[model samples]
Target chain A: MDERFALVGLCPAAEQAAPKGRRPGKRPALAAAFLALMVLGCLLFPLLLTKDPASMDLSNYAREPDGTFWFGTDTMGRDIFAMIWSGGRVSLSIGFLATALSTVIAVAVGAVSGLAPRWLDALIMRLTDILLSIPSLLVIILLQAALGRANIASLSLVIGATGWMSVARVVRTEVRQLRTSEYVAAARCMGGGTFHILRRHLAPNFLASIMFMVVMNVRGAIVAESTLSFMGAGLPLDTVSWGSMLSLAENALTAGAWWIVLIPGLFLVATLLAVTELGEWLRRSANRGQSNL
Target chain B: MCETLLDVRGLCHSFPLGAGRYLRAVDGVSFRIRKGEIFGLVGESGSGKSTVARCVMNILRPQAGSILYRGVDVCDPAQFRANRRMLQTERQIIFQDSSSSLDQRMKVADIIAEPLAVNHIVPPRGSLRAEAAFQLRYVGMDPAYLDRYPPELSGGQRQRVAIARALTMEPSLLVADEPIAALDVSIQAQIINLFRHLQAEHGFTFLFIAHDLAVVRYLCDRVGVLYRGKLVEMAPTKELFDRPLHPYTKALLSAIPIPDPRRERARTRFHFDEAAFDRTGGFVQVSPEHFVLGGKEAEP
Candidate 1:
């Protein structure tokens, strides 16, 4: 791959010690503040929810919080705040784990397929396109229906399998651009194998895009999980979630007991908003990396 | 007698012309590059000059012919893969656009050290930083630049980093494909002089490929002219310039724009139409080490 036609080997010694100019931005500060708050709030859930979320009280059913229960009671007399906290772990885990797993798979597959020879690239891209054409929700639903009764793992698998296409596409484009660069050619000249180059150079260089995609994918996974749970296809009935809470309270909305749905809905919206904001921040940073010239 | 380090024989490459037709980019091009000498490849755009360089680098596989290094054919995939480490250690390349060529994610030190690490020429667990710094110094860069990214550096600096990376493995032959084309004219001279000085100091063989004849004239010991994937002429620089056997070479020489406005006004530019020679075959020798493809030898 000795594609390098000319090499420049002289650096300006006089300017070597000069510091690079910095661009001003407050985005990092905002992101740090939000993330810190989220960590604190999430970490306190177990300590806050001492009682089992499914524990029922026939006597205090639908009682508003006055002294004991802080967020009032559901139709089964379970605490609303306690259920939200207890259920947060599963939803957050599904979102983070599914996104991470899918991203890793996409990066590996895309980098290899993208950097492969023309025929291989064509084959991989065609397969990717076919996969992408299948509607995500429908695919998840089909897998769940075929498998019969989806658990958290199966739900994550369904979401992750369908969610990889966009990441793969993004990585493929990056690898294509990078393959034309001289360093990759230089690496080839140095007897670095295909996998070696991908692992050492291509993967590292494509990190900004990969990170941005992962952040966005996490948000997407969260929304997908919520949707599946809302439709009664995600998690079991024993598991409590923001979506399940809303599903249960949907019938009682006209009975003047609006607190059951309102609280969980607000939490879901807030969580989604926070994740979307984080994704935007990551995307901005990735864009800055791309515009380094 | 010079030892031939690179021997390119009967090399031909082509792509689909369209509608089941194919166009040959390099046809039966045969030449030998000697160790410790800079061989210049000069041609206009679409002349397949760069294609020849690409073929030698194994970036683009040729349709026919053999590229031999040290008396072994490298066109075979098995042989090429088996001897890849040796090939990389023996030969390296620099590109036209330094910015596009350099990996933006890498720090100056890591970029320079990549060749050494990839080749395993140096111990992996040992102090690569110290060795990288020494190599950087050899290329006129200071130790302070080890941490800076490519985007933080200027064009010339980036190119320097690129060169440093190529040289880290101590390759005996370097292929430079218009190294200074992307830089400012002022910076071009500096980089060109740097290359000349480095070649002289290290005694490294070079295949200097470029479109600028003037730069080729100043830097190369011997020059070869290519037209549409065929070598039209090859001669010592002085001999070729003084008495160009090929009409194409003559036309090319006449086209070098004089840097000075007054000199430009005083000079006559040669007119050339590429289509006029389309019907002709490949190059034929008219003098010792000099040739032209077309039949025309008479002055216009």
Candidate 2:
């Protein structure tokens, strides 16, 4: 039998047909449920925050925590809670949007590269390697510098452009494997064209790997955007990003106005952790589904 | 066996090895499968048996070959495409390891209906469920199994589903590549018997590829022996088994153990000297419809 055509061997009937007794443990769905709620809460928080993210009270600059402000005030006397919520909207959205864009780019490039003839596959993978070898953050920085200051769209394009190489490489390997699978040949036997094979046979099987990459990249994108903001390359100073808030609080840190940096930093950490955890959970769930088959 | 439906002539395929080396995987193999005949292709691993099957199905192009279906050259891409619908409807492949052959995400019904969907034989919005149900029952699968995913099926059941899926196209040729090798021994016999029964009922031609001679003997009416990349010997099943002319064929046959260990010990032990196996010679017809190549008999 062709190794490429070897069955995934996890079919549902495989379990029933096996002369065995014990079944494997399935993934607990609660973790995903909790993570989903957290993501929804984060997504909706900015929309719920009534005050303008940049709206500042000059009289209350650097004020300590009080009943009026749940998270006290930043250097500009902006409500830390409101700013964090609003900044989170940009950070999280950019992360996900950029990750999605990159995933599409990578999957397309990789699948094409992998399924193409040997020379073409090598060409695409070599291009991927060259892109992957360069420091992604440096590429983003260079692009941002050359292309001008960071708006959400520009930042996303830069991050997305640099991020696709890894995904392309991963998807390329998967495509290479899938291109030779029996179902793929079956589709061909049914007179399916290359596009049909790509759309039906190759794409769906590798979607899980792509999704996992997207989730991980979201964390990376968020952190990248925050880093850009800290360097004064991201959203405008008045935009009240968590990064800009951190930038503003840097001077106040020595004066013991700790809430200026601490709260926003915690928020960034939580968001990254939440997304990473969510990605890991999704990967495990997919694996469990395979084993159950 | 019935009237010949597919005629393959002088098929040769060679792939470029690194550093300008040429590795031949299929060398001048030729055979004719009659309509409703079970033609077995037997070889060890790397013997090019699967490659031959691929060439017959046009999954892999042969550098020098002509596959004639009803006297039409199927090797030509344009002609093959022109007859694509007929090809799909008249020929199908049942792959080894049914789970891998089936799309994991698809339900049993959807998997069976894929050919129909792709060919547009069934309307996009038509009663695909009923069609899927009909195909399922054709392979002895229960209609209730339709809603279930591939993963829920056992190996024997999955192979049966694979057979059903292939037969759904109403193909005259079913290229089953090591269909039962991935299955357990106990289940292998059942799958083999099911194939036999289906062939008996449907009168479908089968290009059954396998490394197992015993199984091939049970399933095929005519047998072709593949060695490395060459078709070393081909004859009617009984003749090929009784009088294997090629050294490779003789070696392969000797390796098949007789059912009783005591009788097996008494059988001649053929030496498969790899050094001698690598030597090459062109095929020569020794008897009517029987050929042998790369041995002292052919050389002299």
Docking model 1 quality class = acceptable
Clashing pairs in 1: A4-B93, A4-B94, A5-B94, A5-B95, A5-B176, A5-B177, A6-B94, A6-B95, A6-B177, A8-B160
Candidate 1's DockQ is 0.45
What C-alpha lDDT does candidate 2 achieve relative to the native structure?
A: 0.80
Q: After superposition, how far is residue B264 of candidate 1 from its true place, in Å?
A: 3.2
- lDDT for residue A28 in candidate 2, whole number 0-100: 38
Q: Give residue A177's lDDT in candidate 2 (0 to 100).
A: 91
Per-residue lDDT of model 1, residues B67-111, tens digit only: 998876778899877887788788888888777777777788888
Output the TM-score of candidate 2.
0.87
TM-score against truth, every candidate: 0.91, 0.87
Locate the minimum summed-lDDT window of 10 residues in model 2 chain B: B291-300
